[model samples]
Target: MRYAKSADGARIAYSAGGAGEPLLLLAGQGNTHHWWDGVLDDFRAAHRTITLDYRGTGDSDRPDEPYSTEGFAEDAIAVLDDLGVERAHVYGTSMGGRVAQWLAARRPDRVRALVLGCTSPGGPNAVDRGDDVRRSLARPAPEGRRRALLELMYTPGWLATHPGPYRTLGDPTMTPKERLRHLVASERHDAWDALPGIQAPTLVVHGDDDLLNPTANAALLAERVPGARLCLIPGARHAYFEESRSVAGPLVLDFLREHERA
Candidate 1:
């Protein structure tokens, strides 16, 4: 694991693999760099993929205080700076997508393109997962919580094909507290009005059956961002990356490639 010092001087943990145009991956809340395990190979095939564990999650330094989405964005920028990457395609999922949007809006020149998956603009229409979902997320990882999370994240067909490293759910390494903090940060984020400010070429991908962020959020993003394309994966759910990597991977790679060529 490598480290980058954020503006706030917090050391962020990240890993770089593959070799090609730089592609920084910002993971969703509660997730660490390992969360991208499902799609890493595909991304690595075409780009130098950098996967990071956000502050207070995974192996990154966790500061005791209120976490802000803006802080996550700064951490991303710090990672890029540490790697000497002036500009690169930025792809984020879920909460990570929120951070990516902020990064593109605030540091337009540093972002070559944007790919938002299963995320929202934090607008009025943003879907909330309800108290049950929130309670489930907040409580300790019960025996079936991981599977339940997988169900909410992906469609049944997806779960059938790729069962995932399910054993990890019970692994001692999982951090429930950090995950709860991530949920808190996500609930507080409100970037709806800032969508138009993102200048980078953007692609919004969502699952038609996504109950977490809802498919409408993707529509909101496409509608707000001029020329931003939207792709709705049929029957997929919030965790589209794990659910339909064959589909999501190609679509993401294609977008990055198209922009790189232009």
Candidate 2:
């Protein structure tokens, strides 16, 4: 892992691997740079993939305040700038997608193409997570709470078929405060008014059964962004890339290649 310093002097942790066009990956809320491990090799085969832990997650710093999508976007730009990467394709999942939207709109020159997976543009137009899902996030017991959260992310069929992912996923390294900060940041995310202004080619991908963010959010995102394409994986859940990367990975690669530059 390598380190980059944000404008605020925060130590942003990032890892770069693979070879080809640069692809910057922004992970979900409380997710570290390794969040894309499942599909890293696939991406590396075609692009130089860079992943980073959001401030307050993994090896990154935790400021004593709430986080914001705009703040995280700046953090991302900081990492890229630190690496001397002028522009690259960006892929964001879940809360990271919110950050990506803000980045593409606020700093269009830093982005080449965009991929938003299982996320929403916050505001009154967005649908909130269900009560059951919210309850699943509460911590009565750490293990049980994690299991509940996993249930919400993947379908029962998927769980039955893939019984070992939790072992590989382990647990998030975020503290309770960091989790709350991330949740607040995600809730406050509002990019609906800015989507139309994003000049990068965009792809919106989501599972058909994402209870946390919902598939409808994907449709709304794709519609709001000019010329954006939507790809809905049938019968998939919120963690589509982890649960079904065999399908989503190829689609993502194809999209990046379709817009790949010489």
Give the alpha carbon lDDT tens digit for every residue of 1-262 in model 2: 8899998899898999888999998888777866787778889999989999889988888889878999999999989998899999999999989999998999999899999999998999898888888787776897887787787688898888877645223226777788889878989999999999999999999999889788899999999999999999998888898888899999998999888876
**Lowest-lDDT window of 10 residues in candidate 2?**
163-172
lDDT of 1 by residue, 1-262 (tens): 9999998889999988899999999877777887788678999999999988888877889887678788899999999888998899999988889999889888999999999989988846576666777666555656566666767876676568865664113223546676666767887888878888889999999989887777888998898877899999988888777667788999999999998834
lDDT at 177, model 2: 85
Best by TM-score: 2
For model 1 the TM-score comes to: 0.91
Best by lDDT: 2
The CA lDDT at 169 in model 2 is: 35
Model 2: residue 89 alpha-carbon error in angstroms: 0.2
